[model samples]
Target: MRITGYRALNTVQEWGRAVGDANGVYADGLTEVPMVLVTTDEGITGVGMGPHVELDAVFAAIDGEDPRGVTALYDRMLRQMFKAGHAGTVFGTIGAFDTALWDIKAKAAGEPLWRLLGGRDRVVPAYASGLDIDLDDEDLIRTYQQYAEHGLRTAKLKGGLDVERDRHRLSLVRDVLTEAGGGARPGLMLDANECWSRKQAVRHVAELERTLDLIWVEEPVRRWDAEGLAAVGRGVRAAVASGENLSGLEQFRPLLAAGALDIVQTASVWGITHFLRVAALAHGHDLPVSPIGTNPVGLLHAAASVPNHLASELQVLQPPVGVALDLRIEDGAFVLGDSPGLGVVLDEELIGACELQPATSSFDGPGVRPERAGHRLLAAAG
Candidate 1:
């Protein structure tokens, strides 16, 4: 069926507790979730979740094209932004449309997205990520206890501010997961969110490694610093995982060629096509690929088809307000239902009824880099 038009809206995810990393924290734990609905001539509408920048310009490229030809249309959307450059928020816009088109293609085929993507298994392994830098010790225990109840033997904590505090928090989470696993050795990970310098990353992770057997350390240095990342990887026993902030495959080429990243990662908001391509690239390098996002169900379908999917980050247990998915997290994995397409159903009325918070400044927010992030090294030296 030919594409007709699209509609965009916003919803919020109430995280129940303050969520942040080394960058910052939202005290209210509320964040915006933008959505796009692409409608076709045949009355089928596909849903995609991401930012809403340059939607009109990006959507114009595939206005009358067949939604089933998703791959070609993805390239078309990228070319539409060739002169303007398709990085940052614009890339997310393209990804939103690309995922919606894939949703439509799978729905038209009358099959679940996993089956349409040739995934053999419906279950995708998962690891809990709480974004819990602002959470207190009691809240931290309570947070991981919930994930432990879900049978998640692996968890990633948000840290890199203070080594001693991070070590204490990591121990708490590990104990909880290990108990949940009946004394099985639990896998633990840390996300510094690119707050540390190369030396700081190596030093901080080396300190934590003395006690915690970490599975990986994510974004220890900046997203584009291939040499710094390689240095951190060389110094630390745990693997280095990054690339969620990177926009395209070309950006990953240097990191791959330099043998920098041990575990490659891509954000779910980057779309299925991008994740699939990144996965293929990582596979060629003999490295494992993981996905990072709040709701990564769409990528999980694609992840199921990839041979090198290590694990997906499970940020929140529930879907965003007024949205539902045809999937469930069971026994430390996400099990996809037989719902066609992305299995996302939205209640626009409910979303509209919900109160909207004031927009956060670009310079602030959990994922944004803090002003004095790496400067702490100077204080420590003094």
Candidate 2:
């Protein structure tokens, strides 16, 4: 089978709570458009989510393609295009298409992607991610309490602003867990979102080292600061975790080799196939992997396919509008579905009915911006 056509859908929704990460303050919520890539052969179609691509250009690039040569086709697009910007939203868009191609291949073969990945017992553990940073002490505790009741084993808190405020919040969460019992004290992790400099990261995180009992402190310094990240990893009481911004196995070699990062996180932008490749490279060095989310579909597939991954990141609060694609999340772990490839499907009627729209231009804002191409490639391979 070959890809006969492709399409893009960009949707925006008002986030219930403003989310702050190493990226910046998402004050008015976020406008995230989930691009869909459609591949058809004999009219049977497979769909994947490509984020921001000049979708028109993407269609022209891969309109007529071999369904089997998914990897080669992906490389062809990368090699041919002068990918602008650091992470290449366009290439990331390509990732969506590559995913669609894989779905088609798996469906044709009558097996799931996990089976292809050296099949293990399905269903991997999940942790609640995309938690709001601005919640008050009371609300934060309530949130953790709720997750604990739901059978979640772990939770990640967003950190990186006021040291005192963060400390207070962590203390509250710890206290709630202690008080609530019923394994309310799930494993805790922290993500700084690269909001601090090397020096600041060291000082601020040191304060929580003894108190929080963090499973890992993610992106405390910055994405490309090898020396700085190494310093934070060495100095902190918690294990230092990073690499969600990273792509390609070669680029991740150095961070793994240097032992600068404790957990090597990969995102869906690399697609599930490459995700495992990077995971294996990290595993070779005895490093664990934690893949990021693009909603239930990608998260479930990655959790199923990659055995070495620590936990799949789930956005409990997805944007308020647009399509509702739900995967079961009980007790902090994602429940996988038996329905064919990726198992989850987008409601097109819901997509059309929803008012969420994509941003007209790229969001240029404060905090650490996306990296440059050369720098990212170097960081990945360093």
Candidate 3:
């Protein structure tokens, strides 16, 4: 079916607790979830979740193209924005349209996305990520306990500001998971969100390694610092995981060539095609790839087809407002149902009814890096 037009909407994810990393936290614990609904000439529609920036420009490339030709159209969309560059939010816009096209393609095939993508298994392994750097000790325990009840034995905590606090918090999460798993060795991970310098990353992770056995340390240094990432990987026992902030495969070449990352990562918001491409690239390097997102159901389908998928980050147990997924987290894995195309259904009524709240502060939010993040070492020295 040929593509017709698209509609954009916004919904909010009520995290129930403050969510943030080394960058900053939304004290109110609310974050916006952007969505797009692409319609076709045959009355078939597909929904995609991501940012809305450059939507009109990007969608123009596929306005009348066949949605089933998703891969070819994905490339065409990139070329459509060649002069303007397809990085940052523009890439996210492309990703949103790409996912929508994939959704339409799968639905048209009358098969679930996993089967359409040639995934043999319906279950994908998962790890809990609470974005809990700002959470107190009691809240932290409560948060992980909820995930453990769902049989999640692995968890990643947000930290990197203070070594002592990170150590304490990591221990707490480990104990929670261990208890839930009947004394099984629980897997623990840390995400510094690129707040530390190379030396600080090495030192901080080294200290934590003395006690906690981290499965991986994520974004210890900046997203693009290949040398710094390699240094951190060399000094720490846990594998270094990054690349969620990176936009495209070209951005990952440097890190891969430098042997910097042990575990490669991509955000779900980047869309399904990008994850498949990144997974293939990481597989060539003999490295495991993981996906990071609040609800990475789409990427999880793509992950099922990749042989090198390590584990996917399960940020929240529930989806955002107005969104529903045909998947269940069971026995430490995501059990995807046989719903055709992404298995995501959006309630237009609920979404339209939800009020959109503006940012509380420019300095405090998910992507806003803290002012003193990389300068913590100098501050300590002084």
- Which residue pairs show backbone clashes in model 1? none
Clashes of each: 0, 13, 0
User: Residue 130 error for model 1, in Å?
Assistant: 0.3
Across 1-382, the per-residue lDDT of candidate 3 in tens digits comes to 7999999988888888888877777888788888889999988899888888889999999999999999999999899987778988789889889988888998998888999999999999999999998888999999999999999999999888778888899999999998898899999999988889899899989999998899899999999999999999999999999999898899999999999999999998999999999999999999999999987888998999999999999988888988999999999899999989989999889888988563554235767876777777542310
Model 3 stretches astray by more than 4 angstroms: 356-364, 378-382
User: Among all windows of ten consecutive residues in candidate 1, which has the lowest summed lDDT?
Assistant: 373-382
Q: List model 2 lDDT by residue over 14-77, tens digit each.
A: 5555555544555655556565757577664566765755666655666777676767776666
**Candidate 3: residue pairs that collide:** none
**lDDT by candidate, in order shown:** 0.90, 0.65, 0.89
Q: What is the lDDT of residue 302 in candidate 2?
A: 59
TM-score of 3: 0.97
Please give, for residues 1-382, the per-residue lDDT of candidate 1 as tens digits.
8999999989998888888887878888788888889999998999998889999999999999999999899999999998778988899999999999989999999999999999999999999999998888899999999998887999999988888889999999998888888899999999999889999999999989998899999999889999999999999999999999999999999999999999999998999999999999999999999999998878998998999999999999999999999999899999999999989999888999999573564347875766787767541211
> The CA-based lDDT of model 1 is what?
0.90
Q: After superposing candidate 2, which stretches have Cα over 4 Å from the reference?
A: 13-15, 28-30, 56-61, 82-86, 178-185, 294-296, 317-326, 357-382
TM-score rank order:
1, 3, 2
